[model samples]
Target: MATTGAVPMITLNNGVEIPQLGFGVFQIPPEDTKEATLVALREGYRHIDTAEMYGNEREVGEAVRESGIDRDKIFVTSKLNNGYHAPEAAAKAFEDTLSALDIGHLDLFLMHWPLTDGGYVDAWKAMEEMLQGGRVRAIGVSNFKQHHLNRLFAETTVVPAVNQIEIHPYLAQDDMRDFDREHQIATEAWSPIAQGKVLDDAVIERIARRTGKSPAQVVLRWHIQRGDIVFPKSVTPERVRDNFAIFDFELSDADMSDITALDRAERTGPDPDVFDYIPS
Candidate 1:
């Protein structure tokens, strides 16, 4: 396959640039994270997404520092865990993340989830203070729905730079993405392939054959074409490299429509509205 050496960069509302495609460390065991992340960097990934909830920040940071690439070249994002949404806990969690990663500063920090009745306004204030101090380049949310976002809009001072959510062929999240776009907040698709369920979908498989790419690649390409930032996870070495190769191909409008039409409003993860899990 021929190569085009650039991964697309999406500029957030605050004028920060983020690579449209990144390496996600969700569900990867802490022991395996460093090797997986290092492989991603070596294969031309300049962004990495990890979270305190994932229990892999230390390894992700270790890989970033050890990649032999300059630290400034990578865009790293991590989230505050669910238990830390209060103002004081949020503040402490941010420092804990920095210490765990051992990275001098963070490129992006996010509130991992909107806990039920969680004091997000206070958490947002804490995040805003961190942003003001210049340690975190950007602050955003994950698993946030429109209502959750609207609450922040009404009570907080800064707009979220990104909304990391569960989206894939079966759960397109069109409305949420539209709202994010309307507000200039980047929509980042997590579980971008529906957690491997869509790879075997007949529609996606057909497109994969047409594009001479794997089913997973086709789905990821669809995400990129739809203008959503995506980070597909794979610990398998070949698949890791394959996931990053989406930058070179183009999905046609018809293909995009066909994929979009396959939406079943299905989700591979918890719905933010009702999910109230607070990890210990």
Candidate 2:
């Protein structure tokens, strides 16, 4: 069995440590989330990324409890949904997340999006309060572009500990990753596989053939070599275990560059800057 020690830890700007590799529960139905999350936990994935919008925090919480791993040993992250950007609404939403997860406190909490609606600044303020109150160990923003982060820095005092964005070999996002690095903010890659779109690419396939790894594994290794944190979502038990097995190998510099050269700036998810839809 793999142990937590096998996973590399990345320290946040505020000194909180997170597993560089984790399990993400996005687009997972509530009923299946518990089983899939349990598989991940048992497979030695100590970090779990989830969002309130995913509507499965309760299941994630259930899995955490059932896994019998010490709560303190697990790094759990959840995000405030898009509709709850107002200060009061954000506060209530966070409280709801805590209740839903049934976890005493969150390891990390994020502003799910930089909503164009005028309330995001206030939402950030709420997150600041959550941090000071000790409800969350670290705070961050997801889907924030460089300009969005610039505005956030101007309006807030606590720099976000992380900026979670869409990154994959096909959409390397080098500039955004560099910007996050310059500001001491950790870059967390969501849709790290390009939603399976890059899995069939010839470049990634060639790297996979040479490395004796799956195309998904090669792409994941590329993200790891680039110093970006990634959590690939998979409901399959074998895949859950396979994803955790990446720490055993390293990617060559040339292979890393070749995979990086495949970037076309494509995104499988919404563009953060212009996406402002709030689901009902």
Candidate 3:
């Protein structure tokens, strides 16, 4: 059914379908989130991804409420912050996020990172409790590598349904994607355009020129063609609309290969292996 938006959705392991292309508010301020999210909604984006650490859940919720779109038609995603990994605090943290968002329930909730601290295993167990208790529809993780996923799967019964990570043409995380596929986890792409770095890349530009699309569109379309759910963030209304425009185009196999060849194992964000650097 194309999931009721310009972009289509992919079904998760738990049977919930999320919009494949989503609006993300990574560094946007709380005040700006409402307007930006409203703009994205107007631009035909049905999925919205935010996190507790983003500090704009309330504003995103306000925009969602004010948009007049039925709640069931929109997919809202938020993540648990790193500091709230302990089992005791996990549910409380979700409550706080719910309060801040002013929403009844989340479409998806993710553990922001897999930490070296012992709290993560407990946190995973708590997430299962919340899932069964119906506080969250889907539970997942972010910034998790295969090692982290292996450790998590070794100790926990419930496998994360999604793993949000830094994935773009430059940092495709192909190996991790294969591992997630083997484990039945969906790989969600954060910074799917390399935070706009690929906009000026020669390979992307070549494809963009040939396709009569912008470099950003080429990069985002690459993700769509690769079967990755990508949430690209942009505060500017035009850019928000521009990012969603990728749905109309399709990248060819050669084009996809060209983009894939650009992978450098480069990351614009933090390394997933170093949870110790994350703040308490």
Candidate 4:
């Protein structure tokens, strides 16, 4: 039996504990999501992050059920799609996610994106209601900048348990991460490797060689050392196994700083404040 202690846990502001390292299912085609997720579970990943936008929640749920792990042993996270930011739509979307995942309750649910024009405050209200209703253990926001989070703070009574964002060596998002820490909101890094863009950098390559770890492992260890929750996506079985193997090593303080200095404010995803387009 795989113990839940394989990965460290970060307690959220609301007292919900989540695995610091998890599996992300983004851009993974729905057809293959099940097998990939099952592989992750078998590899000892207790947390699984997926979103409605990814169109693979059902398959993720299937993987969970078929993995034969106890429901309480795995932590599952899903997000609201952009088009469903309205309060009513948000409520329905939550139910739909539950039905699709068939997990009975969600471990953590987040707003996929802060659609500024889409009444996110109201959507958050519905999320609060979801939490109060006992369907979700924790609620949070994704791709929300400091200002976006400030708006939620002003308009809502519940503080988000997390703020999932695009974070990699190239785009460290230091200021936003600091804000989340100050507010006791856990930060989750989505593209922790910058979609493989930073794996080939000279500095990262040097650290990888010195640590005798792959570039991917070095970068992921950086996120872990910085105390950010990260979920790297990979459909390939070997890569998935490799990603979960990051817990054994430690990076030197200088190596950590060297990687941190690689932040160039580059982003592989859209800026939250300016991104409002919903796919049609």
lDDT of 1 by residue, 51-169 (tens): 99899999999999899999988999999888887888899999999999998999999998887885777888999999999999999999999888999998988999999999998
Relative to the true structure, candidate 3 reaches a TM of 0.96
RMSD of 3: 1.4
Which candidate ranks first by lDDT, i.e. highest? 4
Lowest lDDT block of 10, candidate 3: 271-280
Poorest lDDT segment (10 consecutive residues) of candidate 2: 1-10
lDDT of 2 by residue, 1-280 (tens): 1224778789899999989999999999999999999999999999999999999999999999989999998999999999999889999999999999997999999999997775778899999999999989999999998888887889989999999999998899999999999999999999999989999999889888987899888888888879888999999999988888887788888989988998999889888878997889
Task: Kindly list the per-residue Cα lDDT of model 3 for residues 146-187, writing each as its tens digit.
Answer: 878877888988889999988998998899999998998998
Q: Which segments of candidate 3 are over 4 A away from where they belong?
A: 1-5, 277-280
RMSD of each: 2.3, 2.0, 1.4, 2.0
Q: What digit string (tens of lDDT, one per residue) describes model 4 on residues 1-280?
A: 1125658899999888999999999999999999999999999999999998889999999999999999999999999998988889899999999999998899999998887684899999999999999989999999998888888899899999999999999999999999999999999998899989999999999999988999999999999999989998898999999999998899999999999999999999888878887867
Candidate 4 displacement at residue 264 in angstroms: 0.6
Native-referenced Cα lDDT, model 2: 0.91
